[model samples]
Target: MPDCIICHLEITDPNNLFECPNNHPVHKECLIEWLQHSPNCPLCNEPYSLETKSNLKSDLDKREEEKKKSEEDEARKERNNQIKIIAEKIIFLKFLNMIETLIEKKDFEGALDRLNSIDENKLETVKK
Candidate 1:
């Protein structure tokens, strides 16, 4: 991230970068080389990474947020699917009613043909 810590060049890559506690970014490899000689910051010579507080609350909060988002997305998908199924059921019922009315008018063959193409589960669902 520190393309040029002194001159400020274009930072094109971040994989080989590390930020000190003061937010001064440096190349990880270069930092390693510098640390071999002194356990201080490259820019200000301040002690770096001396404190290692294992605060996992932020990580837990991030995981919880991701889980909540996933749950919401799943619920939205399920609701959309339910709406689609209900719409299909309504269409199925309308078609079936049309066939029944046709049968009542004594158009037996046409009614039977239409009924044969009806979704059986949709009829059962509407019946319930």
Candidate 2:
């Protein structure tokens, strides 16, 4: 059994193994992490082929795109929440203005009716 250059451990797991073009074997996980930093073999310092390098770039690019997409989704959700909060505030302010106008007109009964129609649960949902 040959030792993995990255981990300095003997490669025991056949399934978790990889080999360079020069036939030098290393742990699969170690080689992948190493490839992220450098394109050369860890022990022999032999550079990987264009095909291998291209594949690595593709994988990295895919991961970056996914990260950006996730971030955009989170930002969109936050913006929507903010918009909802502002809308709720606008609604509350409009209702208050209506109640004030009713009071000014001495329509206490109409103001009380509007106040009673407001749902407490809806207010709690807007707070969150």
Candidate 3:
């Protein structure tokens, strides 16, 4: 197997290999990375075609867009989780206020029932 000129590593996967116009071998990923900075073959210094550069740029742009999209998705999910936590806190506080009101009215039994209905396990899990 031919070794990649850029990484100096053996090209084992056929799909991960590429060749320059001068028949110089390189890894597809390595060539793409190198093409971002330079347009010549690393081994022979042969000038690459405009088509090759354009294709590489398109691939790189696509990857960048995908990465940005993934990051945005993660951020949205995190925001949703935070919103859920805030909403739960609001509900918990409302329940506490109700219990407090019951206590102030001297309704101990109603306050106890409301307190007992809260899931202590869920509360502990959320705290941690």
Candidate 4:
């Protein structure tokens, strides 16, 4: 029923609760965020135990690694999307040039047939 000193909120989950050596209550999540900025307990300003600091540091490192991997995945997806867009544009341009060549040869029906064969969704994406 004790409130976490870091967040000023009641500790509802015993499993996620942590206490300083002075018995000051804090939420585990709150302590992790706090530890990034400060090493000492917010309420008592006392240094946390070496084991506690080590565990927190390991958790923080894992969080950082996960975040970096997520960012890299997102960047790779964006790059692939850009490549897809470029490839689509190349295909569309080539189709258009082929149609132009047909028009120059007075093959109006061939040009119209080629235009009609295109997917509407591809046309919409190019328009956007």
lDDT of 3 at 32: 78
Clashing pairs in 2: none
In candidate 4, list every pair of residues with a backbone clash: none
1 against 4, candidate with superior TM-score = 4
TM-score leader: 4
Who is ahead in TM-score, 1 or 2?
Answer: 2
Steric overlap count per candidate: 0, 0, 0, 0
Which residues of candidate 2, in runs, are more than 4 Å off?
A: 1-54, 126-128
TM-score of each: 0.44, 0.60, 0.66, 0.69
Q: What range of 10 consecutive residues in model 1 has the weakest lDDT sum?
A: 51-60
- Alpha-carbon RMSD of each model: 12.1, 5.3, 4.6, 3.7
lDDT of 3 at 90: 78
How accurate locally is residue 8 in candidate 3, as Cα lDDT from 0 to 100? 92
Model 2 agreement with the true structure over 92-115: per-residue lDDT tens digits: 778889999999999999999998
Please give, for residues 15-114, the per-residue lDDT of candidate 1 as tens digits: 6555567777765545554554566776887766744112223544565577789999999999998997788778877887898899889999998888
lDDT by residue (47-116, candidate 3, tens digit) is: 8777766757877677668878999999999999998888777777787799999999999999999888
Cα lDDT, model 4, residue 86: 89
lDDT of all predictions, in order shown?
Answer: 0.66, 0.81, 0.82, 0.86
Off by over 4 Å in 3: 5-9, 12-25, 30-53, 125-128
